[model samples]
Target: MADIDAIVDDLDAERADLEQVVAGLDATLWRAPTPAQGLTIADQIAHLNWTDELVMRAIRNPEAFADEFEGVLAPAHAVESISAGSAIVNAGTVERSKVPQSQLLTMWRRSAAELSGILRALPSGTRIPWFAPRPLSAAAMAASRVMETWAHGQDVFDALALTRPPTGRLVHVVRLGVRSRDFAYQLRGLEPPQEEFRVELRAPDGGTWNWGPADAPGKVEGSALHFALIATQRLHRDDSDLVARGEGPEEWLRIAQAYAGPVGRGRERQRPLDAV
Candidate 1:
């Protein structure tokens, strides 16, 4: 069984890591453009803050969340295409960007802390409504938060030309990446491969994280950080060191998506710093 407390703790840690990076930024740096086109560092935090607030609503009042979600999916606001969905999601971020940097930071910090507390108190087997096709257990929700924080934080780090050291907390993202393999295909209107793909990643702690059967014909192997990057759409497959041993795994790498949403316009391939 997934340990809810542990997941929540990791979520807290993930938020703290990003908060530390942004907490000291001045107004100019706060408005710095991230790799995500047209979104500033402030906008990224605003997006996280808004989503955290939404998750709290989902947990505290399912009916209200459902009502709001229905409005989001209403005919006038239906997400008919990738750009349409992105416009809906970015609308709040754009408005929130007008807030002063200090106030936005305070808002995100408060919401993140409150979210951790709420997730910690969730009853066992309780499921939370989300934008996805199905509800998620509290633990799954918390882990997804960690993935978002980390993925968005990467854009912040890159904007500042900094490298974030890999950590064991990445295991949450790796697991999510593996679990969402089929969803990645499904979101694109393609059938998932029937055969399971073996995935082996070298974790930051010098340990091998393995999933799938030993004799699986499709296999992906490489650094956990790279896999997580590709899965989150933070890095393109060609920009990573991952190796796919079969057509199934190879194609999966091209379109891997760990988060729920419209297919992401993933980062463009760029030469590694060392190679440049």
Candidate 2:
């Protein structure tokens, strides 16, 4: 794993970039449409901010999470109620579920700050608890933060007609994403791929990230941010700057996921960035 300091720096930089974008946005754009299905830009930010808090809750007190974990995990979208939404996403639902611009902005602002502080203050050597049937190290937990911030940032940029310059630490998130390919495949109840696949990415500071068994036969390479975006399904293969070369490259790219959990049949790709 990369040094914790480097990871924190990457996380902080992305957080700062996102804040700058939201700070200048008018109220109308707070809930503006994005490429993410029916979700507004506000919903994207709320998902990141809320999920980060939920992840932290598990890390802070693993045992407590077990008490109500199953019920909350039942639905990934369109929760039965705001109360259920809050319970599952570790957020207070009524406040976050509002449609008004002010409420959405407040939700994004406050949650972003709290999420940043949680990841930033965690001791370098700590191992955070993951959702289920998985062991998580401090590095893994931090990587999830990187992945979420980058993935959701894609939403804001897609909505704002903005572009995100690739960052070096993205290599870390990309690597995690590559390594999770089999898990993504399995999420659909398919047999895991047998042959190893190479995934190469550039780090935020211009380092390279590679993952897969040493002897893997093929490779995927490009800007780390693009690779991360593609894997998270935030950017489609054609829209992203990343490239995949191999027999199943396109298919693999289509299904990749990095976060820890039981991956559901993934959400379908949204329309072109401009269509929204």
RMSD values for the candidates in order, in angstroms, are 2.9, 5.3
Candidate 1 yields a Cα-based lDDT of 0.87
Candidate 2, residues 1-276, lDDT tens digits: the string is 456656767777877888788766776887688776556777766677667667768767867764556444333321232235344553443345465656665766676667666766777566654453354666676677777777778778878999777766576677778778777776656677688887776676777777776566767777777677767776666666667777676678777777654333444445676864
Residues 13-70, model 1: lDDT tens digits: 8888899999999889999999987888998999999888878988999988777666
Query: What TM-score would candidate 2 get against the native?
Result: 0.76
* Model 1 RMSD vs true structure: 2.9
Model 1, 26: alpha-carbon shift in Å?
1.4
Candidate 2 — what's its lDDT?
Answer: 0.66
TM-score top scorer: 1
Q: Which segments of candidate 1 are over 4 A away from where they belong? A: 71-87, 272-276
CA shift of 142, model 1, Å: 0.2
Candidate 2 residue 88 C-alpha distance from true site, Å? 3.1
Query: Which 10 successive residues of model 1 have the least lDDT summed?
Result: 74-83
lDDT of 2 at 177: 81
lDDT of each: 0.87, 0.66
